[model samples]
Target: MNKISRKGFLKIAAAAAMSGVTAGALAACNAASSSTAASSGAAGSYTPGTYTGTAEGISSTVKVTMTFSDSAVTDVVVDTSGETASYGAAAAEELKNQLLNAGSDEIDGVSGSTITSDAVKKAAKSCFAQAKGEATVTSVQLPTGDETDWLGEEPDIDEAAITETVDTDIVIVGAGNGGMFAAAYAAAKGLNFRVIEQNGNVQDTRHWVGAVDGFGAQEQGIKMDRAKLLSEVSRYASGKCDQRVVKTWINESAEMIEFVRSIMEDKYGVKMIYTYGDEAKWPAENAEHNTDYMYPEIEYTYDRSSGAARNELLLQYIQELGYDVDFKTSLAKLEKNSDGRITGIIAQSTEDDHFIRYNANKGVLLACGGFPGNPYMMEQLDPLGTSVTTACSYSPSDKGYGIRAAMWAGANLDKEAAPMLFDRGVVAPGVDGGYVDSDTAFGGKAFPGTIRQYNPGTQPFLKVNRNGERFANESSPYNDIVYAAAHQPGRVYAQICDANILEDAKRFHTIGCSAQTRNAGEAYVQGKMDEAIAAGALFKCDTLEELADKLGFTGEAKDTFLATVDRYNELYDKQNDEDFGKPAYRLSAIRTAPFYGCWLGASLLTTEQGIAINEKGQALDNDNKPMPGLYITGDMSGSFFANNYPCLMAGVAMGRTLTFAMKAVKQMAGLE
Candidate 1:
């Protein structure tokens, strides 16, 4: 054996191809004694030696030193100094154990600390390849960007360059679901109004909508204790929410939703149905849950996922009242009078490239959704740039034009955390990857799979990060799994399965969408898996060792991957999961050959961070005082969520949007 410098590994890349690692891993003649500190079966290209290497991690850089003699790793030292020492400490400990178990540079990444784990693997590989006199080293670069990109510089266009003007008592910006409701109430109140919609029509891209809140529709005869509802929401808001505003949200949701329902059903005969899925129903009778979170029942507009809803109905009602809206028109800015009061609005026609001004005699309301389509806004809210992961929020890239118009006009904005979630979906076939079951990732469209087809991709089967380490409880709900994935090294995870896993999902009582319907046959599901594997959405390998290597596992990762499967199989045999407690039925072992996997990025519904508002639905400034002549509704205001979407509040975003629209309409029209 020959001694080499740290850089020696990089020097041998071309030379090591003649004797590749794992070339004869299983031969009996390869055995070496423990005294030699080498592989018991001295079969691969390790070349018996010690070496060191370095790699980048989540929050820091990591250095690794390894001792491999006779093709078997005998010792490992991980230096995770770059990762805020405390957080990296535990990760280092976990990585050491994983490395020792595999006795080779093929092992699992630490679940909670993927960045450090990746660093360890890369570092180990440097040593292994160098020891083998090989120069080739695998590198896994993390995806990068400011995870939050929604907040950016305000629009720079001058407002004085107005080309046209329309004077009205009330001017509404945006024609989405929330804006439409405000428009209808203004129309009903006989207030002079004009609506500027960026899209050609009232289009909303939400498939699921509904909320179970405190005060439901009184006329519908299902109401909760208003006081309790108010207190609950106020608590949920964590003192960050205006108690008064929360109270109004609780008091008005039912009436607003019911009123819209009445207008749509009684007049048009259109019906609302409960959206069915994982989030469809409220929490059941269980100790870990309460009833109030179950109060406000959620229902969806029948059929069309992106079709008619309350807002669409409200748009019709506004038209019935003889109010006309400008399609393809966008709000450019809001002008204030010398007294600090909102006076008028400037807008542009997307169709003709022309600007129009609307003088507001009474007020101007901005109900465009939270800056979902603005990358600058995302950058501000989520510095990690996770928004770029998938097409969860697919609104027109108006870059939050309406929200900025409000902010520029002296309206206050809330800088709270907004977490995007993937309700369901799969890695799209073509482009990088996306949620296929719930969201469209590639080409702005979803794949052709019935719930039974793509649902298997999302079911809570065993999963691991890029380092081949199980990072979460595979049986947990969508939110838990997603939260884990978001914090991983690359903010990504792989759902592990053998070729037979799909068949097991079909044959056994798998949870998630599978519990709702029978999956496609085993062959069909395998075919789908193979297709995803070919597209790189999913990885396939003849052996687990290959799977571990492809995922960037090193040292003990490969051994741990096999051991993990064996241990999980033992757990499955006993019908109990001790490691993660994944429900027994979901505990199928990864035994079959030609293993498969789908890489899942975090999924999101929509982003709803926005301008703060008062109980009166008036836009508030930094001082928490309402900005006169301005109001926000829909996704534009009343988002009190701290992080994850409130569980059991299916469609609460739409609920709040509609509720605030009603209140904002009343306030802007001076009816409050």
Candidate 2:
């Protein structure tokens, strides 16, 4: 048997064809063993020998050799034929320990390696069966439920089966910003709640690259005006959002921010700093024009602080509250009584494949984030968002599991919210990954390049199709860039920019710059240009025509491309853009002696569509009514933002939603 690495396992498993095994029957195997032991002399007394069994989802084949004498296990040896490296090796070591310790067939499960443990147990069971001269292994009966009824009969409402069970006063799905806050809020109210995270860790990817801006919290005595903050967000959201929701978000934003600040300072002993030079502020002129009649009629204020620190602090606060939080446990199904009232939930731990039925005695809050990880779901939800790669590092488990599980529970589905979109700056191949608002990558130093070169926040640089023809407005907002990228041919690109424009980005690292602008500017300074050139981020040339030729733009289109650059430079000189309404300062002439173009591609972080919930954060059915005993929050509940850009601060919405749900539950229970 050969050893396999963890990376090798993940890479191989991505293409490995898996056959379904009966999880329920296997669960029954545990129960049957316990029952048989009660009826017989001793449950531990079983023959030990080498077993041959096939279990699905194991990265590689495992050979287990065991020796037993006097009805007691003596020694166990485990050799892997092929498996992922670290995880498989860890599991193999754990299996040897368990087999040796049990002294019998009834071995307790190992943590963080539950699924593998089950596989090893099954193989051991096979060995025991063979030693007993059994021709066929007995099948165990598993607990069953109505999956069809849970998912309903409608195609629009996507549903999935509930796999595990947990018992808690409240169950919050998703361990991202919102879900964590929900747990924290519940703890503040003295409620028992459990956060079920599908990922192995909390705040997986959604908040991993986050910059906790837009919250009206005061740090170092610098308080953001809450009303002004609300007004700003409303302007950004384009007045299409629910006013009540927006108001609630604004009003609560400050409290959550302060809450995070307190936790970071007091508990974690981490001083939250206010660094103000990384972002490009909204021009005073544009701010004045867009400030009035903003959709939610609120102003926006942002805290240029570390999103990772904020998230980590908040998670620590939740842990301090004594709430039970489990990671790698996925919600499999929602259980209900005959009256269609949600009674409990079935969840399975990816670690062990063990199902836990969580009885939500109060209510269930679905805070699982959006579904950018699932490509098929993205294409189905927003046909225009298909071309983008999930540029940021996020949770692999955030594949719409909670959304699907909720929809299966007869929840209302919001098709329009299926594909959440976000704008990501192009990272040249040799450069590090795309720039994050916070400096989680790059040692906390802002990327070095001017915003003029890469204004992903505003509009993407001129994107040329395979034939080098420009499509869509190059100066539109990031969302528009995403929409156009999806519609563009071949879904590929080379974004052209010049050195002068890159030099102008150096000012972005100074104080009072927006985090987004700072991130863009720093990309060049952080050796993004050189890195990208080395990594294939840029196609370089001595002349504009040569650059164009390298990019595959030929003939009439090449001439047109040059003409477009000239016209754009003219607009820059004149201080206005007639084509895309871009502000003059953002425009630049592309006639630098040495021209460079970086290949840019579209990507996403979360799915946009999810179960429909009302403004009060109640999970609604297809008829637009609340699902009894169920509430949804976070990305799993739709109708928040049109695209993904921290529409609201993480944890704020979840905090409020769960608080309100807790009150509603109390009222429902006649406790208040």
lDDT of 1 at 60: 40
The lDDT per prediction is: 0.57, 0.49
Query: Could you give candidate 2's per-residue lDDT for residues 1-672 as a string of tens digits?
Result: 122111111111111101111121111021111111111224345543333343322333345555443255455666544444555446677777776776444677556545455556655554444434341333321111112211212111012222434567777776676776666666666776788776556664222111223332232233445566555545544543445655554454445445544555555665544332212233333443242211221122223354444445557777676655787676666777898888867666566444567888877777766655433244456545554442543344455556666776788777554343444445443332222222111111122222223232333345555455566555433445555665555454557667554453333121121234445455534464565456544566888888877666678867877876777677768867677665454456677777777656544545645676665667788887878778766666665554444332323334433334333334334445
Cα lDDT for residue 643, candidate 1: 53
For model 2, what is the C-alpha lDDT against the true structure? Answer: 0.49
**Candidate 2 deviant stretches above 4 angstroms:** 1-166, 205-242, 273-281, 287-308, 388-393, 425-473, 506-524, 643-672
C-alpha root-mean-square deviation, candidate 2: 11.1
